[model samples]
Target: MDLSGENFRIMILYDFKSNLTVQKSFVRLRTAFEDEAPCKTAICNCFAEYKSGRINLSNEFRDGRPSTAVNIDGVRRMIETDRHVTYHEIQTSLGIGMN
Candidate 1:
């Protein structure tokens, strides 16, 4: 099963409070999740960041490319060009994946 947001936060907190080495923490977390925990690399990275005070248990907003698929002008132009245009057609013509 996928870890819920609450469980992920709890895992972070557990890592912090337990003060276990990354490997040990990963093993414990894996056991907690019935061997379906997140990858070791991800767990280690997050633990390192958290120990270094770079991140907290709360979710942070990540900066990345803003979405362009929902452009108003593009949608308006598509509608003007064809009232009965299917969403698939718009996606294909605009080369935008469903987000």
Candidate 2:
């Protein structure tokens, strides 16, 4: 079964609504998706959110800065300027934390 994206999430929601335990749901998902299945922690998180009355199935946006704010042009320029520059040096110069 190619239960990769929306179908996978929808299955989780269905299991939640069907009163299936998180462990049971996780097992089913792992059996269906094999290596493509999400981790157990992810299943737990989804079940927790459902129990908390969350129904939306998509990722919600956070208000803080995006995870990746570094500009590609800036990185390219830096690499051009210092061919041997290490990632640590680039991070230090850009004032960005470990990505």
Candidate number with greatest lDDT: 2
User: What TM-score would you give candidate 2 relative to the actual structure?
Assistant: 0.58
Candidate 1 clash pair list: none
For model 1, how does the per-residue alpha-carbon lDDT over 1-99 read when each residue is reduced to its tens digit?
676654675676678668877788778877878656767776777776677676555545422465454666897899998999998988888776776
Provide the lDDT at 2 for model 2.
Answer: 54
Q: Which parts of model 1 have CA positions greater than 4 angstroms off?
A: 60-99
Taken over the whole model, the C-alpha lDDT of each candidate is 0.71, 0.78
TM-score of each model, in listed order? 0.50, 0.58
Off by over 4 Å in 2: 59-66, 72-99
lDDT digits (tens) for residues 1-99 of candidate 2: 455455666788999999999899989988877888878887787788778887666556422367767767877899999899899988888876784
lDDT of 2 at 82: 88
Q: For candidate 1, report its TM-score.
A: 0.50
